[model samples]
Target: MANEKITEEEVESISSFARISLDDDEIEDLVPQLNEILDYFDKIDEADTEGVEPLFGVHGKKNVFRDDDVGESMSQETALQNAEKTEDGYFKSPRVRD
Candidate 1:
């Protein structure tokens, strides 16, 4: 792990790839932190994983969705009955984004 080194150039390249800009101070601070992270990975690589099955996910791949069926849907009037604001039988709200 001591042999692991994170160069400023590599840090600059990584920041550029992420579409973010970092000044000299930030890059200097980040180099040691990045090396520490790599050291942690080196420690993790030392773990004994013998006879351990690879984990994909805790949940299985089986479908858990309910079957879709045609049923009596709510009418427009019924849907908008409790709304504080409605326009042409539709629920109206403030714009979410520009």
Candidate 2:
């Protein structure tokens, strides 16, 4: 198996460019965690992929083959009759603030 050597300064430079805005204390805490994540990815890179084809999604997956059937639907007048407010046959909810 091959190994990859990563550095804290490289991670710090990336954090800076991405505007991650981590404080010194937070960056100190995240360094080890990020290194662990990268190590896991390094293991994946060591896998045998030379002859394997890359796939964007799993093969042979469909829409689960649901049966299509016509169903009843409410009329525009019946659908909006119980609202606190209605305009042009549509329900009007309270205005939102932020």
Candidate 3:
């Protein structure tokens, strides 16, 4: 890919999409930094990775599966003992939506 430079307008547009407000000085500073990051990615793109298998996990460990076992559980009173609000043996929470 060609060495494309990031423009101030593009930085403003990116900040707008990210819901962030950037001053003129911040935008000016970020242009070169973002461009440098893109240049590093371009260097990475030029690497030769032929015959390399894709790695799934960095730790090289497969997921261990165990059988689910039935366990004893606390009673409703015990569960609601520390609750601030309870109604009809259930925890009551503030209404979130109408």
Question: Would you estimate the TM-scores of all the predictions?
Answer: 0.57, 0.43, 0.59
lDDT (tens digit, per residue) of candidate 2 on 50-87: 98897766976756777888899988888877788987
By TM-score, the better pick of 2 and 3 is 3
Per-model C-alpha lDDT, please? 0.89, 0.75, 0.90
Q: Which ten residues in a row have the lowest lDDT in candidate 2?
A: 1-10
TM-score of 2: 0.43
Score candidate 2 by lDDT: 0.75
RMSD of candidates 1 onward, in order: 6.2, 7.2, 5.0
1-98: candidate 3 lDDT, tens digit per residue: 25648899999999998879999999999988899998999899998989989898998888867878888999999999999999999999999863
Q: Best candidate per TM-score, number? A: 3
CA deviation > 4 Å runs, candidate 1 = 61-98
Which regions of candidate 2 deviate over 4 angstroms? 1-6, 59-98
Of 1 and 3, the candidate ranking higher by TM-score = 3
lDDT of 1: 0.89
Q: What range of 10 consecutive residues in model 1 has the weakest lDDT sum?
A: 55-64
Top of the candidates by lDDT = 3
